[model samples]
Target: MFETSLSGLLTGRVALVTGAAGALGESICRALARAGAEVVGVDLVEGGACDFVADVATAEGNRLMVAEALRRHGRLDVLVLNAGVQFVAPIPEFPEEQWDRLMGVMVKGPFLAMKAAWAELTGRPASRVLITSSVSGMVAEPFKAAYVSAKHAVNGLTKVAALEGAPHGLTVNAVAPGWMSTPMVERQLPEQMALRGLTREQVLELLLDRQPVKRLIGTDEVAALFAFLASDLSSAVTGVCLPADLGTLAS
Candidate 1:
C-alpha cells in the first residue's frame, strides 16, 4: 500500500538516525537514503550502516553525535530517534536496572537527542524530528510495563516538541508500529511463552489476537511512513503519532 519511488523527495537533506545497527533502524536509513537524503547512521556499536557510535541515552552522547553529524555533513535536516531497548516483565517482577535502562534509551534518549539538535533543526527550510514509538504507546499491553510507559512518554514528548517547533518550520512527529518481524520481537517470544505458560505458537497467536491482520509488520513498511513524514508532503502533519499497526489499533 506504499508508493515505491520516493527518489529525490529529500534531495540534499541530511538525516541522523539512532539505533542504526538494528534491523528497523537500518531499514529506515536505507529508506531515507533512497529518498535522496544524506543519511548518517548512529548506534552504540559499529555496523555497515552505522557511521558513528555513541550512547544516545546520555546528554553528552547526544551532544557528541549531533556535533559529529554537523561536523561531517555541515547541516542537519532530519533526526530519527529510533534507538530502543525492550525489557518485558510484570511490574513487580521487573528489574530496577532494566527499567532504568529502558527508560533511558527510549525516553531520555529521544528527549536529549531532540534538545541537542533543536538549534540546528529550527529555522531551516524543512526540518523534521521523527520518533520511533509503538502500539503500546496507544494501548496497554501486559508484561511490558517499562516499554509501554516509555512509549507513552515519547508520544507526549512528540506533541510537546511539535508545538514548540511549529512556528519555526520544524515538524516533530512519531511512528507507532505494531508487532514487527524483528529480532527484538523474536527475543520477546520466549519471555512471553515462559511468563504465560504457553507454547511458542500460542504466544505468537496471543500477540496477533487483538489485531485484525494476522501478520507481522515489515520494517520497510514503517520506514516508508517515516520517509513520507520526513518529506515536504507532511509539512502540515505534526504532533501526531501515526500508527503502522496493520489495523491493530483500529480493532
Candidate 2:
C-alpha cells in the first residue's frame, strides 16, 4: 500500500542480495532496482528474480557470487546478506544437523559473503553491507534455538564490520523485522501449531500477541528500510540494527 517511489536513490550502484528466491529477498531486489541500483540476486535455487543460483552457505559460493556481480556490473556498492532458513523444534529434541545447517546459511553465509565482497565494497566511495537479522536477535523465542543464535551472531558481525569499514567509507548495518506475512512465516504456522497443540487460528493469535500492531508485517515495508539504509541519506547511520518489529520491541 505504500506507493512512494524511491527512484534515483542509488543510481549507478550495484547491489547483490542473497536468498533472492525467497519472498523477502525477492522484494528487496525489486526495491533496490526501483531505487536505480543494478541488482544481482543469488539463491540456492533459481527463481524469477535470481540472476545467480548459488548456495550462500559455502565460501566458494559466496566468492563466486561476488565475483559474478562485479564481473557484470563492473562495481559493487551494496551487499545484502539476506539468506536464511528455519527449523522449529524444542532444544532438547533439536537435530544437531539442522542447527548446523541454519548457522551455516544465516551466520556463516553472511560472514563469508562480507569477507568476499570486502575489497570491492571498500574500493568504492560509499558502499553498504546490510544483514537481515531478526527480532529474535534481540529477544528469544521458543523452538528456534538455531535461528535465534544465528541472528544474534549476525548482529555482532554487523557491528564488527561497521567498525572496520568506517575508515574505508563502507557502512555495515542490519534490519531486525518481526513476523512478516511471507511463505517462511506461513510454513512455521504448522510447526508452531503442533508444538503448542493449538489450532492455526490460535497460533496466529500467539504470533500477533507479541506485537501491538495486531497484524503481520509486509515484505515491502522492510525492503523500503533497506533501500534507505543503502542510500546516501543513511550514511551517518551505521553499526546498529534497526527494528521493523511493529512495536514488538517497544512492548
Candidate 3:
C-alpha cells in the first residue's frame, strides 16, 4: 500500500462514505481510514464490506445514515457523497424509469445526504464535504444523459453548499473523474460495445482515445484525491471541481 508522508492527516476525525460497497467507494473508505479517520461506510445491500446499510435514494435512509454514524462515532467530520449507479443507453430510447433511478441515486441522494448531515458537518471545525462527480459533469457523451445531468447537478450543489458553508469553516468540493477502473465501468463496456457497434478493444480505445493519459484512472488514484480533500491540507479549497481525469476535459 502506498502511503503518503502525511499519513494520519485526518486523525481524530470521523467520515461517512456512501456507496461504500462498490470498488471505488471501498477504495475511498480505506483511504480515509488509513488517514486516521473513523470511516463509517454505508450502502443498501447487506454485503460487500460497508459499515452500515441505508438506501441513499430515500430521505429516511439518508437520515438513518447520519443517525447511525452519530450513534457509533459521535460526530461527523467528512461526508463523501459517493453512492451512484451508471446508465448507458441512447437518449431517445432511454427508459423514463432508468432516468428517475439515476437522478434519484445520483442527484437527490447527495442532496438528501447533505441536507441530513450539513449541520453536523458545520458543527465541527475544518469539516468537509466531497462529492464524487464525473467528467460527464463538465462535458457530454452519447447515451449518458441521465448520468451526465445528475453529475452536473452535483457540481452545482457542491458550489452552492461551499458558499453556504464558508463562513462556518466547512469546505465543500468535488472531483470529476474520467474513465475509472471500477466494476461499474467494466459492466458498461459491453453496453458500449453494442451501442457503438464496436468490439471490446475498439470500445476500450474509443473510451480512452480522448484521455491524454491513455489509460483508465484507477480507484486508488481517485481515492487519493478524496483523501486529500478530506484532510486538513484542503482546508482552503472549496467549490471547485478538481479533475482527477486524465485530461479528458482538456481535449
Candidate 4:
C-alpha cells in the first residue's frame, strides 16, 4: 500500500477471492490482480465466472478451495471472503431454511475458509483476511433480519481472528459497505416493493436515505478499500470494521 501507484502494489502476493461471479467480487479480483497479486477467484458455478469454482458455504467445499488455491499458487497471502446470499423478509415470516442458508454462506462459509487457510496464511511473514460485513452489521433494518445478523457475526469473527493471529503477524479485518449500485442490490428492489408496497423509486430512496451522500456505492470504491486492507500499509488497522458507506455511518 506504500507504493506510489496501484499497479504492482501487491507485487508477489497471491490472493484468493470468493463470490467471483458477482460484480463486486470480480471487481475485487481485478483490482488485486492489477496491483500485481495472482488472484484466484472462487464461485459456486462450475467453471463459471472466476479462476476457480466451488461452493464456499460448505466445509468440504472450502477445504477443497484452499487446497486448489495452494496447489495453484503454493502460497496464500490474502483471503477475501466475499461470498454471500440475501433473503429479505419480515422477521415473523422469515423462513428458517432461508436463515440457515444465509448464515451458511455468510458466516460459516468464512469460518471454514479461514480454518482451511490458517496454515498457509501463517506460514508467511504477513497475511491478511478481509471479510465483507455490511452497514446492516452496525444498524439494523426491517426485512433484513438474516443479513444483519450474519454480518454482525462476520464482524465478531474478524475481531476474533485478529486476536488469534496477532502473534503470527496476520491481520484480520472487515469492510462494512452500505447499499451498492450492483445487481445484487438491484435484485432486492422488487422484494422491497412487494414487502413494503412501495414503488421502485420509493424503495431506492428509502434505501439511500440513511447515506447523506445519497448515492449507491460503486464496486470499484469498495475494491480500493480492499486493496488497502490487503496491503502492508494497513498493517496497524487489524480487528476493525472500516466502512465504505458514503457518509451513511455519519448519520
lDDT of 4 by residue, 1-251 (tens): 32246787788999999999888898888888888999889999743248777889998889988998889988899999999889999999999999999999999999999999998898787899999899999989999899999999999999999999999999999999998878889899999999999999999999898899988888888988898899988889899999999889899
Writing each residue's lDDT as its tens digit, candidate 2 over 85-188 gives 99999999999999999999999999999999999988887899999999999999999999999999999999999999999999999999999989999999
By TM-score, the better pick of 1 and 4 is 1
Model 3, range 121-217, lDDT digits (tens) per residue? 8888899999999999988899998999999999999999999999999999999989988889999999999998999999999999889989998
How do these models rank on TM-score, best leading? 2, 1, 3, 4
When 3 and 4 are scored with TM-score, the better candidate is 3
Give the root-mean-square deviation of each candidate in angstroms: 1.2, 0.9, 1.0, 1.9
- Candidate 4, TM-score vs. the true structure? 0.96
Candidate 4 regions with alpha-carbon error over 4 angstroms: 1-4, 46-49
Off by over 4 Å in 3: none
How would you encode candidate 1's per-residue C-alpha lDDT over 125-188 as one tens digit per residue?
6899999999999899998999999999999999999999999999999999999999999999
What's the CA RMSD of model 2 in angstroms?
0.9
Of the pair 3 and 4, which is ahead by lDDT?
A: 3
- TM-score of candidate 1 to 2 decimals: 0.98
Point out where model 2 deviates above 4 Å.
Answer: 1-3
Pick out the ten consecutive residues of candidate 2 with the lowest summed lDDT. 1-10
